[model samples]
Target: GIGDTIRVSLTEEPEFEIPVAKIIANRYNNRKQKHGIKAIEKNPLHPFEYSKRASKEVVGIGGKNAPIVVEHDFYFENTATDKLRITELAKWKTDADGFPLFTFTDFAKADKISTQANFVLMNLSDFDTNWQDVLAKSQNIVLVFESKTEHSMAEHRRMFIELINNDIDLPVIIKKRYSAISEEVFQIYAAADLGALFVDGLGDGIWIEHDEQISQQRMINTALGILQAARSRITKTDYISCPSCGRTLYNIQETTARIREKTGHLVGLKIGIMGCIVNGPGEMADADYGYVGAGFNKINLYKGKEVMLKGVPEENAVERLIDLIREHGDWVEPN
Candidate 1:
């Protein structure tokens, strides 16, 4: 079953480990659920599935097509040069390579912006109706926010409510500024602040800033992780592996790691790794494929809940799993 929250911890340094975590966290982004046996099919116009709020299209950002990834930095100092930089950067494909850069303090510095600038992000605290007139002339504008603390989910919610009440339909990007903290603490902060907004269909993107002690890549991975958890995007493969216990038949930790190495490149695939029948097929509610330990040194493979192979040798399990994915036409060779 998909849990409300998830955290990935490792013995290696964050820089080395974040890539692996991201490989799993972003698996469900942009993925559509295939219809299975069901008593009723879903209506195309389900209220929760559609939003009346206006979708804004920025260069390289197609709005509701896919959530944009925003990055903040001290890219430009002079207002005159900022305009030139925007043009040069876009020409260089900097904005098109999945991340578009914005200056954190540019709003206070520049009265007018270049047409090449795709998004202007201002803190919710500084946001006012007067600026709306200025932004109305702009192309892409996003509301940037920083909540009070880890328990300040309501604070974030209020900001969005205020925006909607004012009829402001600009996309929002939640920004989290943090000091050196434990991965567990960061995960909680991200899930509560950014994850909550994405789940509510509020935020269209995320920007995470941290002290020099933290890796920038780690922040990007966490942002992607939050978006993935909210089901707003799907960029990588997801795993639904159970914790090992007394019912296990083989070395689950070793087996899971091996399985991940082989099939992790298949984006949007959900692979379940279970210890035994105690939490096998029935437990993997969202897994598209499953590997369950059937007995001592033996495994049962499933395509969803249906058993596909039984009592296969543990040595050949990973290969068999790949074969199953290939048979289902989900396999893609890694470049």
Candidate 2:
């Protein structure tokens, strides 16, 4: 299965290329799923519980902190090449000696394990019973899983299940590496691969690495997007908009864009933009604010499920929505 391939030809150039590794990896992952792995019988603890159980407190990571994004040191230390400011990137924790506090090592290499690091990262693939003693000695250790197999997400899930079964509640970080793929494909793959673990309450943080082809900013945004989608962390405005249809009124797409342009800076706020009243109120039940089409050129604004204003002209709806956010003390001037 790992040797499978299909040929692709370009009509103009009369040249062909075969993506042997991609094909084999996809097939291998698919085949591995035919026989299901054991389900997680024990219900894992809430993310907050795991954080509190951590031996040491690290700001923005573990110990009642929201899940964090860990970027490569180059993005933070090498400011000359990376135009983005350090404040925009992930923050690194350092020891009193001015060295990085986290140590990443393969579990297979017993001699390489670090004893001084505050946060130690060990691979899940090379797990052995002998490492249990090492784990017991470390008070501030964080397991990091980077699956070598194509079916990585599944393997990560399996490792989490094993940890839960054995009563190990050490904070875990999901690590993924990508290369030789377009930026769009990388985003989709990273979200699906890492978001699944967060959805299961299995990971405490996320670490993403990509080849030089992808920018550092893109990688940071992607990590934040995955966390936001999982509902585990909130760093930006969240929008719930409906697909336009026959019943739609006003310019749904244009209105949504305009609303986002104004309110995108409102962090952790859920805004709903719906085409019509039929499904608007019901769909955005959890949204903080809602804008729905009340009539041909009229809009209805809502604060939660309750309607705060009705029959407002469509032209003035965006301004009125801003007023509503301000009235509730949620508005902040865009920086």
Tell me how many clashing residue pairs each candidate has.
7, 0
TM-score of 2: 0.75
56-124 in candidate 2: lDDT tens per residue? 333224555567677766222112233211121113322233213333333333343334333455555
| Candidate that scores best on TM-score | 2
- Report the poorest 10 consecutive residues by lDDT, candidate 1: 76-85
Q: Model 1, 118-159: lDDT tens per residue?
A: 455444454443565655656565455565454335556656
* Stretches > 4 Å off in candidate 2: 1-60, 74-119
Reference-based lDDT, residue 218, model 1: 76
Q: Pick the candidate with the highest lDDT.
A: 2
- In candidate 1, stretches whose alpha carbon ends up further than 4 angstroms from where it belongs are 1-54, 72-111, 116-139
